[model samples]
Target: MYLAIATDGVELQQPERTNELYASYWERLGPDEITKLLAEHDAGELLPDFNHVMVPVATLRRLAAGRVPEGWDDDFAAMLAHAREKGWLSEDGEAVRAHLERER
Candidate 1:
């Protein structure tokens, strides 16, 4: 699944006024990385890094279909909620940024 990692304390507005302030670091996690993420999450090691992780809605759906990795519980839920509330989640939950007016 793909994610759009965001930078903190940054805001760049687009003409459409969609608040495209957050610069996204697009990533598609391999199995090993996904495993590590789950491990870190379970161990409470991901709190400091949680804000950077912006799981797309599609990825969220994929995760829902597959069983959540063992040990991912309240913490994961909280982060997902935060991502959604913070507008980090992509509209369709896909990492498509072609329409965003990125700052070069």
Candidate 2:
């Protein structure tokens, strides 16, 4: 399971779909743990596990353009770098809808 966060909101998701959202490291979390994380996010707490949150390419672009929430844990650069390293990012750092491209 992974926590998917975007400009819309957060959700607990299985990391299967490529273009659905950005996925983080695999962790078998219980429902209670998921709820706690969501609650913490709603309460504006900088998630201690913020690094586990993956920002989609679209959201990343918005973030770079100052169009999204700015209260993140200042891990944008690290996340972006990780994305690039993992081939989850486009050449220009924008959205890539195809999983094949993502794997390339």
Candidate 3:
């Protein structure tokens, strides 16, 4: 959720906006690095500007099919937790699944 803060004459308020902002970061980093990056972001130390994030279909398929790379399960679990926390999973999971199935 994107919080729009408005200040008017000594009053700071958050305005309700119809649009929400969401972002994701995916890279080829090792598991430890990925965990560190997610930790930094979760601690509000990093802010990335992104909208709809996607992984390569092939990679996603492999992941969904239980063929993860070495040490990827933990990273994937963290990603899932993040997505669920942001409410993006409910909104996008079906579409992503469909896309992956189609790519098979």
| Cα-based lDDT at residue 7, candidate 3 | 20
Q: Give the TM-score of each candidate.
A: 0.25, 0.29, 0.28
Question: 67 in model 3: Cα distance from truth in Å?
Answer: 8.7
Q: Which candidate comes out best when scored by lDDT?
A: 2
lDDT tens digits by residue: candidate 1, 22-64: 3233344443453365344321112233333332334333434
In the range 1-104, model 3's lDDT, one tens digit per residue, is 12111121111011121122222233334334433543433211122322223322233333234333455556655555565576645454531111111001
What's the distance in Å from true for residue 34, model 2? 24
Cα lDDT of all candidates, in order? Answer: 0.35, 0.40, 0.31
> What does the lDDT come to for candidate 3?
0.31
**Candidate 2 lDDT, tens digit per residue, 1-104?**
23453334554454232233433323544444544554555411222444333234543343335333453324444555666777755587753322211111
Worst 10 residues of 1 by lDDT: 9-18
For candidate 2, give the lDDT: 0.40
Q: Which has the higher lDDT value, candidate number 1 or candidate number 2?
A: 2
Which ten contiguous residues of candidate 2 have the minimum total lDDT?
Answer: 95-104
Q: What TM-score does model 1 achieve against the real structure?
A: 0.25
